[model samples]
Target: MRETAYWLINIACAIVILVLLGVHMGVMHLDAILARLVGTVPEPLAWENMVNRGKSTTQVVLYIVLLGTALFHGFYGLRTMLLEFFSSDRAARVITAGCVTAGGVLFVTGTAVTVVFALNGAG
Candidate 1:
């Protein structure tokens, strides 16, 4: 059951990413098409309040999941890819560990910063 739950979370994460990818593509294409049609180029949207925006509750949840999953997936991928490509002995393992550790620190620090910003309404 636990394994299934974890698998589901992974699948959900992938699905979330896939959804974001599609949304991104659609927005890019739409922007270009709209620019041509409207004869006015739209400015790129900027995100303020890096922690808590006026976004929906669902968006907040998705943001957290996206942050966590992307960090884990990308970092782990980099580590494994490096381990495969580099045939060095201690140096490679040390580098892999270092990469993972850096990724972990990034995730933790980022999350903490966002959480503080979120709770304090300073975002």
Candidate 2:
């Protein structure tokens, strides 16, 4: 049951990653297309636009969410792959611990940076 829950969470994370990355690509990469469609800023990568996004609470939250979901999804998949190769209870425990720790650290750090940037007004 526990393993099933983890698997489901990992799948959900993948879906979140897909949706968030799609938004990211549309905003950051498809600048020309979006400009034509919506008369967006000439350069999505402009410093002014980046600063504006960084100062936006909604953008900060979305960035943190994307960071967390990507980290969790990647780490969980990696843990699964390593377990398949190791195939020992001890190895499984160690892999799980390492992945969890690393993922947690990355998530916290990313969230902090996002919050700080928003608080600082991205100047």
Candidate 3:
């Protein structure tokens, strides 16, 4: 049950991240730039307007979620692979646990950076 839940969550987060990246790129490049070129109103990129009007909040949250989920999934899955290849008669689970801990630390740091930007209204 728990493992299935994790897999489902991993897949969901990957899909969300992929969609968010696509939408963000499309807006910044296709929509926003085209709007500017056609409208020709003297203004900056107007990212603030993009955020205020467009679905910027979802993009920001999705970015963090994507990073966290990918880190956890990739590192833990890699650790599992390593366990299958190597390890003594024991210590397999221990090593995987260590990887999980390390991945958790990395994800926390990454998430903290994302939080700083989100809170400061950068992203």
Best by TM-score: 2
Least lDDT summed over 10 consecutive residues: which range in candidate 3?
50-59
Candidates sorted by lDDT, best first:
2, 3, 1
Q: Which structure among the candidates has the greatest lDDT? A: 2
Question: Can you give the TM-score per candidate against the true fold?
Answer: 0.53, 0.92, 0.59
lDDT of 2: 0.88
Query: Looking at model 1, which ten-residue stretch has the lowest summed lDDT?
Result: 46-55
- Selected candidate, larger TM-score, 1 vs 2: 2
lDDT of each: 0.63, 0.88, 0.67
lDDT of 3 by residue, 12-123 (tens): 7677767766766655557757576676432335767644432456756766777776786677577667877777646776776788798889888887876666666554
Candidate 2 C-alpha lDDT tens digits along 26-85: 999988888899885557778888988998888988998899889988998899899999
Tens digit of per-residue lDDT, candidate 1, span 29-122: 5667767767875443535532335244554455566678777667656666777878698867696678769878987877676556556655
Each candidate structure's count of clashing pairs: 0, 0, 0
For model 3, the superposed segments whose C-alpha errors exceed 4 Å read 1-8, 28-56, 87-89, 121-123
